[model samples]
Target: MRICLVASNRFAIREPFAGGLESMTATLARGLAERGHEVTLFAGPGSQVHPEVRLSPLAVVEVSAAAMADRFAPGPEWVADHHAYLALMLSLARTGAEQFDVVHNNSLHHLPVSMAPALAVPVLTTLHTPPLPLLESALALSPDASRFVAVSEWTAAAWRHVVASDVVLNGLDLAAWSPGPGGGPAVWSGRLVAEKAPHLAIDACRAAGVPLVLAGPVQDVDYVEREVVPRLGGEVTYAGHLTGAALARLLQEASVAVVTPAWDEPYGLVAAEAMACGTPVAAFARGGLAQVVSPDSGVLVPPGDVAALAAAVVRAARLDRRAVRAHAEATCGADAMVEGYLARYAELGQRVDAA
Candidate 1:
């Protein structure tokens, strides 16, 4: 199948990925390419995705996560650049639709979703985040609502009324993350933002008397300076932003992975990654974390309950690491994700041809 993947222009789809969405996009594109499917990825400038997958650059300049985070109140230059990038993406999708069998949009922007009806090819948009006003508004205007796919059941439930969407859980490359030497400390990995709640992970690990290693891009500098930096020392160490082998090593070395999300995470990719490395997770039972972390793989505590989280961390550390790895392999591997999307693409293609 000829597939055109639309990625966000927020950052280049290269190593040291900005977030889970970028990582997932890269994994899916590569997996499909390796399976002999013709894949073209439209991403930010300088994106170094799989050599097998064709690259179609979007933005001329890469936008950092920190800058993207300030979208609500961005400078004039930032706003102009972002709008231009969006325009380019929409134009590409509009003009290039007939060239591909399917257009899979991972770009969080609404323009693609809103424009899906006019395109010649089917557009399958995977919703990575919960329903926002902007996206919900665009979805309302979308003609073919069934093209949307939510990353989790929780996310689907949140926006079912706006647009009927299939639930396809996010997945990672399980083979790349194998069981490793695990006598190390607990770990927390994600964007260093308030919603991700890295500080909460720190508090829980400290209370449990477990050393914690925090790793990810500092998405919010003020949040880190005010909340994270003060808590980092001795038992709590910051490893900065990591990706690829570095990230896999951190997860493999940990006895347990700690996930504390302030918001309702659409899907907890880090927890799945940790479990893939044969490391049990101790995650707050919020949003999709509740759906992803099974009892055999990890322990879930009430959201924001630091005491319960701490206790759960201790219990999780004792879980069978082999079981954790097996659970991840069975449920959220990259192969499974690609298969899910392919099935959806075939179905959508049939619908488009019928139309």
Candidate 2:
């Protein structure tokens, strides 16, 4: 099958991935290509994908999330740039419709979903984030509304009122995230934003009497200064935006991975990655974390309860590392994700053929 993956233009679909969406897009593209399916990834300029997958740049130059933030307070540049990116993606999708059997939209923008009815081929929009006003409006205006998939059951439930979506759990490339010898410090990884609540992880790990390592792009600098910076040092240290081997190593070496999400996270990829690395997770029971973290692989506590999270860290540390890795291999491996998506694509193909 010839597949085209439409990625968000916010950042290149490369290492040191902007977030879960980009990582998932890259993984799916590579997995499909490895399966001998022809895959073309439509992403930002600096994207580096698998050799088997073709790359299609949506923008001439890569744009950083920080740059995007800078434009947000000044004027309409941010909005204009976003619209331009979306426009280009839609134009490419429309023009290249006949070249691919399926167009999987992971852009997380409303334009593709809004224009799905007019596309020559089927457009499968994977909702990676919760439904916002813009996305809800787009879905309401969409003529063909049956081509949406959600990353998790929790995410699907959030958008059930807007559009019926099937749940396809996100997966990680086991080869890249395979287990390593444990006995390292506790770890927390994700965008350093208020919503992710990395500071809470620091507090929990500290209370658990475990050293903590923080990793990932700092999405909110002000939050970092006010909440994260002051608390750094002693047992807590920031590893500064890690991906690929570095991130895998961090997860593998960790005694336990802490996930502190303030919002209803659509899916907790970090938790899955930690499990894949033979490390158990201590996550808040919010959104999809409960679904992703099986009892054998980790423990979930009430959200915002630092003391409970700390106790979970201690309990999770004693879990068998092999069990965590085994659970991840069985449930959240990339093969499962690719297979799930392939099934969806085939179903959509049958509908298109009948039409």
- Per model, state how many residue pairs clash: 0, 0
Q: What is the C-alpha RMSD of each candidate to the true structure, in Å?
A: 3.9, 3.7
What Cα-based lDDT does every candidate model obtain?
Answer: 0.86, 0.87
Q: Residue-wise lDDT of candidate 2 within 124-166, one digit each (tens)?
A: 9898988888778888898364488899999999998878889
Top lDDT model: 2
Candidate 1, residues 114-231, lDDT tens digits: the string is 7676667777889898887877787778646438888899989977878778888888988788887676999999899999999999999999999999999999999999999999
Query: Which residue window of length 10 is worst by lDDT in model 1?
Result: 76-85
Candidate 1 displacement at residue 45 in angstroms: 1.7
- Give the Å shift of residue 242 in candidate 1: 1.5
All candidates: TM-score: 0.92, 0.93
Q: Which 10-residue window in model 2 sums to the lowest lDDT? A: 71-80
Q: Itemize residue pairs with steric clashes in candidate 2.
A: none
